[model samples]
Target: MEKVIKSSDRVKDHGEVFTPKRIVNLMLDQPEIQSKINDLQATFFEPSAGEGAFLVELLKRKLKVAKNKSVSAKLFNTKSLLALSTLYGIELLEDNVEMLVMNMITTFNIEYSNIIQEKFGGKVNQHVFDSAKVIIQANMVQGNTLEKITSDGSPIIFSEWKPVSGNKVQRTEYTFESIINQSGPTGTVQGATEEMDLFADTDFFADLQKKEPRMKKYALCGWTSIYKQEIV
Candidate 1:
């Protein structure tokens, strides 16, 4: 229930009207949607994630699976991390973006902390916490979905964060156009005008859109590293 209706002037200015939770649930409760959303690896996108009301419910639904009797800390962390990472959002207002990020991240952290304390009486692993934070930071972006670019005019590149070898995660970035193209390199691809093996990372497609010579073909960047200038 997140009703932040602005003045008529503001509404006219931005076309902003919050969707009531009742409607959100009715729309999302379809049999197919219920099945798919329950899956731990499923991805969701909300181009207009006002204060993340939808995301909050989505996270709650997914965390039920993480709360099983014999669940390990690793299981909880991975499942929860995947749930958050798989969510993609684009918000036009900076304040709304901040609220969305804070709401979602805080929900995850608090719920995750409680689950671990009750189940295992232990604190969250730093690696897992940092990894989850990074995923939230990258997945919930500030941009215009229609324009498909950030406020700074960079292509809205969404990163897929996956659990890789031995507890670390691999992040593969994809532009909005690349993701919806259907016939491009869907997951991580080597940068060349040649073939690369494909794997499903959500429903996104990607390509080796060339630019510079310095960046490696399949390099993973640090949490705050700028995108390679070539992708510009």
Candidate 2:
């Protein structure tokens, strides 16, 4: 077992072993998985992103592709969003979670800086960096995946970020259970009464609207611009 944490007591308690870099790379080198390493729209999920070993490699590969496709900051940021936003991870320990976020955003900023200097004559907007940080913060979380509950005891929920027209992004939140039910091998939303209805497909918004929380939907602008400070 690879011991990432120095404390043996904590390791015993949390089983916090991290996969070594060599193993991680070997596993990701499989032809099918390697093919999509730089595919901007492809998604990645790491259950325990300890210091983001695998995730960092993913960012490196994706940013390499983005660097190649750098025509302008606008086009590059829009495409880079797909690569950055599609990554998701859940870490039980808060420190691990924070580290994972740091790992991701730092890699993002460094890569963005490198590519801009190499291809775009070092002229780029700060908003692009802000956008990457925002996406990384939202994507990684500290939570118990087995329990599938947020810290507040609510069902785990993840937001989907979609790039809309006019350089804006649309965010849609969905319950973890709902997402699995929709995509599971069962190939059907066939489940108990607590589950979302398959019949609700046609009237999706109506059902979603009637729900207690009123499905969280938001549109974020300012992505078209360069980052000055923070995410709006």
Candidate 3:
């Protein structure tokens, strides 16, 4: 049985209680979730992802379907990455976030390794593994979902990885606030905005509200090389 509560202190302090696997399956087995899991490009976000109990199971289901669709090892790598890109989560505790990331990467690697070995009698592709690491690190973040900010009080940001033509993907960054508010273009690449440039000339107050880059456009790259994210 999975330990639902880490400790009494954790339970009292943070109300840290993990959902059991049986309950997780019951929730996921619902028709709505079943339909989403069937679509490889469909995105899912967990507002309070504690060590990825739900995300991991979701990933396993997606990878299982991806394996069925893959004919070649190359295609498998891309499909697996695409599946990984669709899952996102936020955890308040830093330790939980760290574990979440590790669990995600480990689960991805195991699936990838098994598919490659059984299907192609080959080794895990380094580039694909590196790209998976990048995606997992970016998607699973340590932050308070209620406040939509990291522990440092900065707005949480998430990269939207959209698969473009063929094996290429386009990445766009959005503040969690922007995403939740639906205030601006969420799909397009972010460009200069006067709001982000406010107080630029005042060096004294520069540190008051740490600003993200005014412009963020990453060059279209193959899924395996997305980690580089060469600016366009």
Which structure among the candidates has the greatest lDDT? 3
How well is each residue in 136-223 modelled by candidate 1, as lDDT tens digits?
Answer: 7878889889877678655677776655655445566676656776434352323322333345353224332322112223344332
What lDDT, from 0 to 1, does candidate 2 have? Answer: 0.69
TM-score (C-alpha) between model 1 and the true structure: 0.74
Per-residue error for 148 in candidate 2, Å, reads 1.1
Assess the local accuracy of residue 161 in candidate 3 as a C-alpha lDDT between 0 and 100.
92
Compute the lDDT of residue 47 as modeled in candidate 3.
Answer: 93
TM-score of each: 0.74, 0.77, 0.88
Q: Write the per-residue lDDT of candidate 3 for residues 12-119, one digit (tens) a residue.
A: 998799999999999999999999998999999999999999999999999987888888888988999999999999999988898899999999999889988898
* Model 2 poorest 10 in a row by lDDT: 184-193
Best by TM-score: 3
Q: Which ten residues in a row have the lowest lDDT in candidate 3?
A: 187-196
Scored by lDDT, model 3 comes in at: 0.85
Predicted candidate 2: what Cα RMSD to the true structure?
Answer: 7.4
Alpha-carbon error at 169 in model 1, in Å?
Answer: 3.3
Tens-digit lDDT string for candidate 2 (1-232): 5656658886899887777878888988898887787577678888777788899888888877766676776677676766777788888887888889998988888887777777777565677777788778777877778866555444556767766777666666666657766753222222323554857645766544333232444546545432222232
Q: What's the C-alpha lDDT at position 5 in model 1? A: 90
